[model samples]
Target: MQNGTVSMAELLNSSSALIFMGTGCSSAVPNAMCLIQPSDPPCSVCSQSLSIPPDLNPNYRGNTSLLIDHLQSNGEHSYILIDVGKTFREAALRWFTFHKIPRVDSVILTHEHADAVLGLDDIRAVQPFSPTNDISPTPIYLTEDSMNSVGVKFPYLVQKKLKEGQEVRRVSQLDWRIIESHHEKPFVASGLQFFPLPVMHGEDYVSLGFLFGETSKVAYISDISRFIPSTLSVISKSGGGQLDLLIIDTLYKTGSHNTHFCFPQTLDAVKTICPKRALLVGMTHEFDHHKDNEFLTEWSKREGIPVQLARDGLRVPIDL
Candidate 1:
């Protein structure tokens, strides 16, 4: 690792820690949007408006990758991954290569959406070489609704037993944690405590964002319609004065999106949370990295907050 930084095992032994290995958008999109380039149809501005990494960089990837570093003095300093999207496999590979994380102790599922959970099987690639912790399952925690939905969509994990002990080896055993509906309460599973917030996702189902703590607290709430009073209350109670970090959704630009946070509103929420730094995640093709940062820098200066616009493989140091 970096100088003065402890190993994953050592960090698990200490307290007060956080790490974010990737912060791309939700799609793990390539350098630019696949459709409509600078020379394409309509006009240059139209094509330019839909790009993220700009047409100049060829190696950009869309979607966000998050790693929660929590280790408090001789305890298990494991990680809590917020969302594992369709690009999860690639995201995981990139994360390991960049951060050198040999294994991820657990994963937290935000919702059952494809961009959030489709990479569930990618864990197989990181399974302990010698099978640490008694060959137990990797331990994935999710809200009740998410677990039910995951069970339905990926039924192979819990299907009937064909052989004897074969059932024990399926993606390991999926340990289920039933979360409360209060949404503001903080609960613990595996070895960490998570502050759960209820969010509305397009009238279809209930989605959740979480604040997990191995030692430090990081609030992750993207893909929500609006942050209601209850949500704010949870923020104040869980985050208290401020947060170490906040990963929020910024799906649209400045306009009002019916089911998601527009740029200005997201900025407002950032003002409320007032974390040391806020990184925007879950972005769509509507944002252009180089151009968006110019606007974000002005906003950050006006708001007196530090904001980092995400791109694929961007590794940010979360102060330990």
Candidate 2:
């Protein structure tokens, strides 16, 4: 294999999942306004990390996104991306470019929030290097509600037409497919099947989390305030009552939010699911890598489960 290229064989042989970006909420880590000055009083998480500078801190994360790679029967690689958010372009340039990821075979959206779908235009960057040459555009699997919102937000991309006298620029060529939120019947993308697990965003909204792989399942729920009972049951059945890895939303360390999970809720969900390992995502500036790690280490031992924080560029083998 080349130095930067990720071969299908490498991905298929792995036993872990790669977390391209990890953070709760849309703001991400190292918030500009939250940065503390020398004269300012210490600000717990952000204050202690100033010594290394925000740019240099490896813990600084982007919006939540996960990359799942699989090898097709024809010896081709399939890269599936979940949730292309506002920070996707920067994240891609920072990491995906260095790794030489050719193209995204499919995109499965969780919801239509700006932070989750604003980067649809950035898909144009991958068109030139796409391995597939079929007439169909890149496939994007999403729910009906999300599809409508995406069309409203990015009419040019969805409708494949430019406004009158509009300056011509490359836009994403996508084939939107409506997905059913049924865990029993999964949708296949690039040889890998995904089971949509529905969860509650808040009192007024809903979101979908995906369960991937067969024998050793990996569940990814980037933004959720609560899990539906049926969804939890599906997750449990995916791994015979214990998932291989559960990547969940942990938006804040404390305080309550109507639409995102706090540390207590996140921990409770993790415990209920009882995954072999858990990696928390969707974090904010309140979470300090150094401090959080220490706390999670102790918590993991106490609970008898391995849990850790997910950071950008962190790769784990998806051992199926």
Candidate 3:
């Protein structure tokens, strides 16, 4: 753990990359509703998903999540995961294996929604099941409210105890670390400094986005309906006033959502942040990756900023 602030030189030299573990909404792409209904043309995006391999199919998305792959100066490969949503098992099986990623070094959660936190138990796959195992418990970073909800949803994980007269069952051994999202405090996980960018998910609920990286700034806002002024200020104050990459939530091609950004809202936020490059995530079946990307390509040409939809399994290396 970096107990103090790290220098820009140290951060620049340490190799790291971002992985889009999943880029779909709660139901993921190829929505069950669309699949069940019989239509003349059918759901174009959902239909194409059936014919291609997942690695090659952008239409085949999983729940929104990100993985930070960092190669420390000491030669340790750190895998810091963000938000283990309901589709986390499928994401881990497919993306982790395909990318050859090892065990998760830590987990940073966005919020307590079922789509974001329901897969907490599945993380046990990477940890030692038996108490005698030598591996240390995985550290989990989340806000207090998120932890409270998590406790209600998975009492076994928080308490880590067997009930009276109940058989022993293995659960994920996690060290809960609460980050004060309201305070917008910065925390270091696996050697990277992450600034919590709190945004409104709904009128009464706030979700966290993250602004991290040193030489090449990257911001992630995977579940936000609207950006609060504080988040915009943080983004504007980032290195040299330029964000290298931004992966944000875009729930639909059009129309405003109550808890997720639609196409217009996403674009408004993007323009406000003015990132050098942007990738939209958390999309429903309304978007066709190829078609939507073509549209974004033209928009990028006109705006002079790159914008595209993020897909599951995409890895973006941070370069100098």
**Top-scoring candidate (TM-score):** 3
* Weakest lDDT window of 10 consecutive positions for candidate 3: 7-16
What digit string (tens of lDDT, one per residue) describes model 1 on residues 105-197?
778776788877877766666775433224556677777778878889878764535576553443534455666645556776545778787
Ranking by TM-score: 3, 2, 1
Question: RMSD to native for every prediction?
Answer: 5.1, 4.2, 5.9
Better of 1 and 2 by TM-score: 2
Sort by lDDT, best first.
Answer: 3, 2, 1
Q: For candidate 2, give the lDDT.
A: 0.78
Model 2: per-residue Cα lDDT over 184-241, one tens digit each = 7689977788889989999789999998877677899988988888998867635447
Off by over 4 Å in 1: 1-28, 31-59, 129-134, 163-173, 214-216, 236-239
TM-score of 2: 0.86
- lDDT scores in order: 0.64, 0.78, 0.85
| lDDT of candidate 2 at residue 63, scale 0 to 100 | 82
Candidate 1 achieves a global lDDT of: 0.64
- Give the TM-score of each candidate: 0.78, 0.86, 0.91
